[model samples]
Target: MLTTLTDYRLWALPRNYVKIADAMIQEILDSGAVFEDIADAPVEYVESRGDLDVIFHELRGTKGCNVQACYDPYIDPPAIFVHLSGNTGRDNFSVLHELAHHQQRVGDAWADVTEDITDRAFIKELREKVANSFASRLLLHEDLIDSAFGSGPVTAAGVRWLFDNSAASMQACLYRSLELEGNRVVMQADSDGRLFFSAANSDELFPPHKDKTQEEIARSFDRLQASADGSLVVRGGYGIQHLSGKSYTNVVLDMVLCDGCVLVIATKGRSEQFAFSDDGEYYQGSVCHDSFLIKDSPGRCSTCNEPKCSKCKSCGCPDKQPPPCTRCFMLLSVNDVRAGLTAHEYC
Candidate 1:
């Protein structure tokens, strides 16, 4: 459905790049090409199936190049050389990316050019982007992603599902899902906390942090620590201050350490009115109102002083330890965090 970059402007990619990517995907779909699962396929196996030779050689110091994969289309049947030294996920992605180039009829011409050196860099960048797009489409089919999100909200679990089911990396899965489910942001930061790359549906909602130093950004998010399981949600004053900017509010963040880097996903909460039931019971009456409210109000129950009455102060229920208010700073599930409220009333 997203035919143009404008339809999915969150990526902030060049219009021409999007145009080419769109055409490539459309052509693949039109030709009824079945995207086979290559997640477990070896590099040699993949190359063989694609009718290409596979070779592994040291390319680290060659031509000042440290690329993980390269496709030499000048050969009779073409060849894809994958750097076995690279990470498995990265190597797999690179192979698919090169295969995409082959599928799109993009070959060594872009690489073999000697004139217009300035333009060569730009052309190479464009071609790389197109190849990445193609690889993403091939590995993570549109239909599979649609089906995953069709059941419910696109939570951290859903992203993990896509990652497990596809040949893409966690970062790739996050970025792809952002395109599929607009209005979200994904950022990758180094272990030292320096932001390396970020992608979003809207810059206004999630601006670039490239200008800030690693320490500055880390301090903004309370010293940004990486979680092994990717379940950490930084909240409270530190999280709120850093996440909520001039154009955003009710921002929720989940971070995980991936290959010595931190991957963060921030979702801007939609403001929804919540009211207490007539009975004044917090759990029973705490319902999200369909109508939207511009400004958050404490509501009638929030200010009610009916005494504890042996009930939990948090939830207004007869219990021992009070449950934290959903409106306030609390560790919530991925789904709840994604559906965070800008305002809420507690009985």
Candidate 2:
């Protein structure tokens, strides 16, 4: 059931819960949780709740307590009853978002709303804003996402890192990741009603959802899902997208890398948002940069970072021999272990 913000237990909340919520917001902001740092957060589950579907206050005294907190403050606590129903859904960004609420002890009690909407309750909106910021940052911590973004192609592989870290939905993370790189990217979904997420500096990739008629979505969805690979390459629809390969393909969807144009649609695919891209542009990311995932792939002193360098005698990076770049040298010094080793899952 959808929860209305106004309807919740009021009298049973902790009298001081409001203050605790304030402190939590301040903490997250002081830590520099901004739009740029979306990928900085850790994505693991905090804990498990029981059969009691929703969690809130005592329903008697003041606005009650949060899921993981007592009347006492200081210890980090959650503000509401977070529904932990996501294992099959996208990466668990929702958990982190709710965690923000929990930490602030923001209760769902109606008293919070009737509390005069001024000082005490007045700051509620601001706190939620901070929690939202906290959640985004904690889930999409920029360093981690940037690391993966810089490391490899913004493909399913990198997304795995986001998933493991809890960066929320692939669409949001990819969009944010691209924004961090200063790229002009526009993302869209023409299925389940038309929806889109466009970069600030870029033009809209797809038309507004309202502008799309039912016929458009239905027809497009049909053409898109007919692929064996469960994906479709967009050729051009609203006269914006330019297809580099086939107009539409079941396996891969290629569009022109430009601003104000080019749209890729998932219509009906395993991945609602084409969050992972296998294009060459992704190879420029740090994850895939000059690194190949191969077991026993000998070291290469060559400037050309390639897998073939492993066996080639002319390669510059020799195994356990003198190093090439000072950076590479030191990296291999302690951890002579190579990329694609069975150690890491990507390997």
Candidate 3:
């Protein structure tokens, strides 16, 4: 039920998530069975836990269960514990994710077995990348994402479609889509006014290294989060936070909605610029940081920017566009279409 596994660079891994998801969806299409919004999708979700978590009730004893994709001990297939935690949180990605997992079960049984428990624990994380890849394509479907993203602006309503289908987080879905369209993205989080997740895009992985005076950063952050309300706001440390300046806003996060995706980097800071600067240069050491360019890569996008063959036409300056790159085009399309629909319906 457990095994030790080495971490592989996503680039070095033999499998390509983009391809795997496309093929998996083809398999479902080829199947004689009906593709109703059944329970086997790759990105299953629910409204109960506002936070995101993947489940594998069906993969426990399955063959490839020891493989990178089938690692969750939380749920076992065939007859899982609960009845339904299903809702379209990922919008366009959930069902596909779960379905792909089901597909993995068919081939994974005996594919490769692990000998330790940690690898098993890591399985949950592994499949997330896989299911994310699969669900994104299946729901977004290439042409649809491309056309939608290319035709107009990507909006929040577009985000709804992804949520409805995949059960993935709003940002995750956006990241996937924008990446398809040749943009890059990163994600971060906050914990006890310290650094947490630093999932940077392949391109801008350098700048955010600069550190503010850790003491001042912590105090400012603690002060802010304590008084944080509930809207996005710029803070002195780390990056940005959910609330503009509400209680508990001091230990803020770097929630930068740049390019087409979003990065929620969180940490503390003594001074605003010390903690975070939009500058691209790097200087200090471990006690310091990376260049601001690496930290804040998406200073390129603009609101109401049109969708050119490149990213947002309005920010039509970058010879390179931005993160959440073009490869993830489908999700962006879904983003745009959903936006228009929501606007038509609500706006």
Candidate 4:
């Protein structure tokens, strides 16, 4: 499904449908449909628009139906035929993705593309991409994303917050919340250590993730077994092995076990430690200036710019012992020591 740049040579790229999707959501909200109301019954909510009729059927063996859901523009009133996949999040997304197709037909958005120059497969891929984009926006908007995540990087709690707040799938929430940086990756794996999918930021320099779960992932599953409170999340640091025979150590990982799958967010190129203050705010304890998540941490050394440890009062600087004075031939006090001088300051 990964399409290269050359494939899009003759076809116009998909337009940004985020605004249109957001507008449609606004219209739905203005019609007195709250999120909770639409969440359980997305098809019902969309069907009420009178633009498209929803039909449920077993899509397999049906002529011309290959996807979980598809929109038929030729049909009078334009019907969206859906096969319930049992996964609520995915089913909802399929509905919305097909709805995007409905919009394309009504607006005649495909007219600008030169379809004859490209094969049908390329066109289908392009349209699918467009529809997926539209569906993602419809399920989760930017405003909601910011409100859920705040200023911190994507965390398990943030992912859970979005899941409870919106009707988007866990996969969609993870995809939408990701920061397009090369130093991070998000993965979904089953309980038995089988990877469903993995997504990395724009940096191709990062090595490919393993097809199956690594040792650390297995350890995480073991840790999850001790959750007496029934908590499904396990967050910690573990080395991740890349496919290139190299391993990134101490990668920050946040994992959540839900819907028979484990969702993981791994951050590389940084080490994070939580240090709390008396004011009830926590900061990233950067012992060696490796972490970039530092926030208002007190006791930063003016010389090294590293935070001084609360207990040791050390700022990652090496200890310097005063040398003996050449003239006195004795150990000198730190304050009295003068470097490269024959005598101390007092002398």
Which candidate number has the best lDDT? 4
Per-residue lDDT of model 4, residues 208-327, tens digit only: 365745556666775655666223433333345555443444356677666666666776432234232345232222221122222434466776555554433434333533444433
Better of 3 and 4 by TM-score: 4
Ranking by lDDT: 4, 1, 3, 2
Runs off by more than 4 Å, candidate 2:
1-78, 84-92, 101-130, 142-148, 151-167, 170-175, 183-193, 196-207, 210-236, 239-347
**Per-residue alpha-carbon lDDT of candidate 2 for residues 1-347, written as tens digits (9 for 90 to 100):** 11233322221122223333344545545655443333333332233222112233334232222222222233344223333434322324444445555554544332343454444442554444344344444556557777666755454335445545553654445443443432233344445424344322211121223333222233455554554633444422322222221121112322211122223322212222233233421111112122222333453224544222223222222343322222211122212234423232322
Model 2 is weakest, by summed lDDT over 10 consecutive residues, at 280-289
For model 3, how does the per-residue alpha-carbon lDDT over 110-188 read when each residue is reduced to its tens digit? 1242223244434554555666666555445545454545565443334344444443555455555444432222333
In order, what lDDT does every prediction score? 0.49, 0.35, 0.36, 0.55
* TM-score ranking, best first: 4, 1, 3, 2
RMSD versus native structure for model 4: 17.6
Kindly list the per-residue Cα lDDT of model 1 for residues 242-310, writing each as its tens digit.
222312234556565555566666665421322223342222111211111222223423333222222
The per-residue C-alpha lDDT of model 3 at residue 325 equals 16
User: Comparing 2 and 3 by lDDT, which wins?
Assistant: 3
Instruction: State which candidate, 1 or 3, has the greater lDDT.
Output: 1
For each candidate, give its TM-score against the true structure.
0.54, 0.34, 0.39, 0.58
Largest TM-score belongs to which candidate? 4
